[model samples]
Target: MANDGLSAGAAARRLGVAVTTLRTWHQRYGLGPSRHEPGHHRRYTVEDMVRLQVMQRLTAQGVSPAEAAAWARRAPSDASLSGGSPDASGGSPELTAADLAGFPSAAPHPGASGRSGVSSDVAGGSADPVDSVPAARVGDGEGGAPADLAGGAPADLAGATPAGLVGSAPAGGGQTIPLGPRANPAARGLARAAMRLDGPSMRYIIEAAVTGRGVILAWIHVIMPVLIGIGERYEATARFIEVEHLLSRTVTEVLAAVPRPPRDREPRTLLAAADEEQHTLPLEALAAALAEQGVPTRLLGARVPSQALLDAVNRTGPVVVVLWSQLPGSGSIDQLERIQAVPHPPLILAAAGPGWPVEGLPPTVTTLGDLASAVRLIARATSD
Candidate 1:
């Protein structure tokens, strides 16, 4: 930075974000350059840069822009100017992807141990209070009223269901997706948000989960359960497809919003959905998880016909290709066969998602069982 300070373009480059994004933060959130000289454009001083970095990091982790800005504005000047130590109101230290990777696969239910202190109150209490309460454990056997995860007082879900959803349910019951007793509080909160079709609250909860827990944990513990419950509801009642669509769309947006590796780093990994397969949320989660690990990927969302995928493979020459399938109709072995027979095949061709048949898979193809394993395998292959 010059003594005068850095121009908006320079600051955006240093932050790896768009100039327009910076301008929006300035206009909407009041996070802008403070240094100005006579008859000269305002420039970002080191202190301003530090604030912007804090804003950028928080928002990237899934914090709402307004809340993130509030924290950014409060960042201490003594904090590292190189985007280190946000220290916003004495929050927990940021967890890197490596740090999150060591977390146990089975996260304790929020009620098992009191809710983790990491606050989920980003929605400013506008979202239903029930969502903030910890979920009840399934087999506690001490049958009593449901207790709030935070305060250990009784809580109710009867009123949480929105009026609009009442008619959407079958005659047998009111609007509710049956998340079994074992569901975590985050997952339960997500289910309620989905039922209400509240996009902003849904994004906040999902993003907070991703930021606090890694993408893999967020998907497994928070997202995947809600999706499964919704799918079951749709199967039984043959309704609430709108809820499913909206939730899926929100998850897609959040995962896509996860920051990618810098533009300078060429992506060596490719991800795609099989032909006619519309379910790509898992792949999106995989892509975001990889990005957290500093690996760039080319995500060809939704359905990809065999030739187009091959064309992409040939053009990009990616070292690793992951093909996802969510149903049997889309899982064609010939796609894998064609990719393997390419003039110069990728080092790893992975068959991910439940769509692939357990038998008759090509020996050269790797099958990914879950998000964490997929990240580890592809990240390793790309690094190699």
Candidate 2:
């Protein structure tokens, strides 16, 4: 047997499937690691990885696991994997098409463990944390999660599949969230993490994106999609509130992890969730994005009663105040009216979040659109 191979966790992340899925594939499909050495656990050879990739793609495309496995088991010996025969539906191919294209062939066999800090030993597989997902990428990728594998696969990170599948039984509710189609791998990975309530993996993927892509890009491409998707899941089933809370808390922590501007500089930007509106993740992203540009802002997180907001406004006398309301009817319009009533009203009173009304607002309040727009507007406003 050739020496290059990956542990179950490393293999799972590479394939973008859960470890249990991997275990199921190994046990039921006979696709387990074929390479074994004197001292270590059975490792997945490059060929083994190729097989798992096939399994993940087929299953993800809605093929029954049993049939997909049968195809996977024969892959090592099948030259048809290169030039695949298409199924009757024409939506999918008979072989793992990803295996035939630049994908499977492009992935280097694990010659020297996968990533910088991970080891490839897995005599007994390591614990999986929410099918540990790699960071989502945000530029010029052209397809679904698996199809985008060539562009977005972080083949080295050691992420194991969570015990439960992503969106399937998230937090053991047995409620499967339809993830729709993911063009962003990070969004796909983040959603999987949220479903598992996998805090560590969620943190890892988010921080990686923020640090590499900057806060705004990360929020728009990576964070918001997952949050919005999860919110929709909650809307449909009224379940996975636990998933939401964990996800929100994890997002808060990661965004907060973004370094703040120097305290010596007085904060001109004021951010707050609207009165009686507790959703503040967007504001958190805004704050972090602003901080990335070295602009300082005072964040008065979560719900702030109208009077309390006025008191803060009066004391700080900020130049810009961004009030966030997630949904309509959850926030009071009186808050904006009171801020307008203040003697030293901010130079720019921005109404952010979807909760704000599009029409009939005091002309003083500017409606902030998306995160990138908010960052640009606020960052520019703060400079002057």
Candidate 3:
């Protein structure tokens, strides 16, 4: 077929994606056939096919469809789509993560994984990961929150975005997490993908962020705002728990994929969700963020019982132990009291997540306010 183009069915077959999916991509993302003739239907040019392939592969790798579309929209002509030689064409040959989202990209780092690494190219290890994420500022306004600020925990999400869409329904359909008018394009892309439960699109956006901006920036600027916005939606309508769960699972997968601290360096930080507490995404973020700085943490993961937590602490003998709680009921004071009462308590006993009471009974316990502050504090506390 000449550059005149391939039919939708043919394009679908070639890309190995369904025609309906192709339609969705075209309608939702503007990744449609660009070639037209006098009497026939529009056909997908080679470039269009190439763009669709990019969208498909990225989504399959756990990137959200909407975000994949964003990248696809600006994709280079003849972009590598599996087994063909791409004929380089008109646009910039290279597309930076910043270019896709209108944000700054991290310098390439030898230490970070390709797209999966918690990469940071800053020298001297002095650059703050949280500080490096670009602002989510929609536009300059007195009422808008500055974009450079980072969110710490679920409780710290008030700083995530400038506007909240508490009761608003989305433009196309059912519901949406409220986004500011000037929301980061990447964030907007992520929100659209999550709303549609487009898991691959979400992963692509996040993994791309992790690859281009490091774990902390990815979470702070891309994943965190969507989370808080969705949580607000759930609060208002009591719906979309599935959306929340899918997004969280995707985040957990990506964060877990971040390279761990070297095996030679023993893990000195112990992380666990409080008893009966199921929320641990924040803790996962902390673990990955710490790992970015070459710090190892033994994450006990969600809903660890008090006894099991204590047993792990005793076994690991970590220098710092961080307990996470996402709600008040699960953020019990007794857990802290008992941990403090352990025969060998970690040097730093930290309370994380928003579930814990600010005024607590345990004197030795310290509250972790947000992701960056937690990472910064724990890395320092357990410095070898």
The prediction achieving the highest TM-score against the true structure is 3
Worst 10 residues of 3 by lDDT: 113-122
lDDT by residue (75-138, candidate 1, tens digit) is: 5575554445443335532433432333223321111111111111100001111122222221
**Candidate 3 all-Cα RMSD:** 10.1
Candidates 1 and 2, the one with greater TM-score: 2
Candidates arranged by TM-score, highest first: 3, 2, 1
Error of 3 at 57 (Å): 10
TM-scores for all candidates? 0.58, 0.59, 0.68
lDDT values of the candidates?
A: 0.60, 0.55, 0.59
* TM-score of candidate 2 versus the correct structure, residues matched by position: 0.59
The C-alpha RMSD in Å for every predicted model, in order, reads 14.4, 14.8, 10.1
Return the lDDT, model 3, position 48.
83
Q: For model 2, give the 10-residue run with minimal summed lDDT.
A: 115-124
Local lDDT at 209 for model 2: 72
Give the per-residue lDDT digits (tens) of candidate 3, residues 323-363.
87755678898888888877887888887654566575477
**Candidate 1 weakest ten by summed lDDT:** 116-125
Error of model 2, residue 195, in angstroms? 2.4
